[model samples]
Target: MEPLIKIEHMYKIYNPGDDEVRALDDVSMEIQRGELTAIIGHSGSGKSTLMNMLGCLDIPTSGKYFLNGKDVFSMTDNQLSDIRNQEIGFIFQGFNLIANLDALGNVELPLIYRGIDKKTRQELSREALRMVGLEPRIHHKPSEMSGGQQQRVAVARAIAAKPPIILADEPTGNLDSHSTEEILQILKGLHEAGRTVIIITHDPDIASQTDRVVQIKDGKIEKDYWNEKE
Candidate 1:
């Protein structure tokens, strides 16, 4: 079967002169559909650059990125925006929820952008909130909720549209250990339900929980391996 995502000899260079820095130095990888993968790297590592590329947020200086067999670089900005909206769900470290919007409202925002009808958006948002164990908090605003609850709301918002891929960047970076565990379990459940989940983090503990780990260092892939699950 064709890989869900493929990147070959990818390079993201900044400045492009004598002082140029290669954020992604000739990196290449393929992710199969429904794989739970982690990309681990420290602060200066190229993981963030890779995440930007994967999420279609930014273009690489040079490389071929094929997402679902479509050439990513060849797409226009509007097309890339549509792809980001329709094909990938993003969960960021800072629970990017609207302060004025309730949980359901936030979750419905993306569906609304997709031009979904009011009735269908409400249903999908409610179901997504339920999946994240936040049904009771549907009407609660972000400020009224705990950090974990807010993050769960963020999760619900991301999955409300049922995108095929979940791209999470340092998803548990701001939470307590308990909250971190909760988020991880929710992500695991999403993976079990057949979503292609990719987590970007510097924590080996988090990476260990994923099915596959891809370690990045100094803008290059240092290692890629599958974990042995019992």
Candidate 2:
């Protein structure tokens, strides 16, 4: 089977020339469909740059990236936006929920952007909230909810469209221990349901939950291996 994602000799450099910094230096990797993986690295270790490349948020300075067999850089800006909406679901540690939008509204925003009709968006948003165990808080805004509840809302917003890949960046950075466990369990459930889940975290415990871990350091891949103990 073709790889779900493939990157060959990828390089992302900032301020190229006299004082250049390589965020990603020649990163070549292939991730299969339905694999639950974690990319672990501390700040300045290039994990964030790798995530940006994987999510197609920023184009690499050189090399190639293929998601689902299509060259990512070959697409136009609008096409890239469409691919981001349809192929990748992002869950950030910051939650990124709008203060004014209620949980259901937040979950529905992406669908709205995708031009989904109101009736279907409503149904899908409700289903997504239910999946995150936030059905009761559907009408509550971010200010009305606890941090964990707000993060759950974020997760709902990410998965509402059932995108092919769930790319999470430090998903537990802000929550308490209990909330972190809750979020981790939800992600695990998604993986169990056959979603391609990629978690970007510096926490070793968080990385231990995934089927595999790729460690990045100094703008290069330092390690890539399955976690047999996990």
Off by over 4 Å in 2: none
Candidate 2 residue-wise lDDT, 40-102, digit = tens = 999999999999989989999999999999999999999999989999999998999999999
In Å, residue 178's CA in model 2 sits off its true spot by 0.4
RMSD of each: 0.6, 0.9
| Residue lDDT tens for model 1, 166-214 | 9999999999999999999999999999999999999999999999999
What TM-score, over all chains together, does every model reach?
0.99, 0.98
Clashing pairs in 2: none
Candidate number achieving the greatest lDDT relative to the actual structure: 1
Candidate 1 CA-lDDT value = 0.97
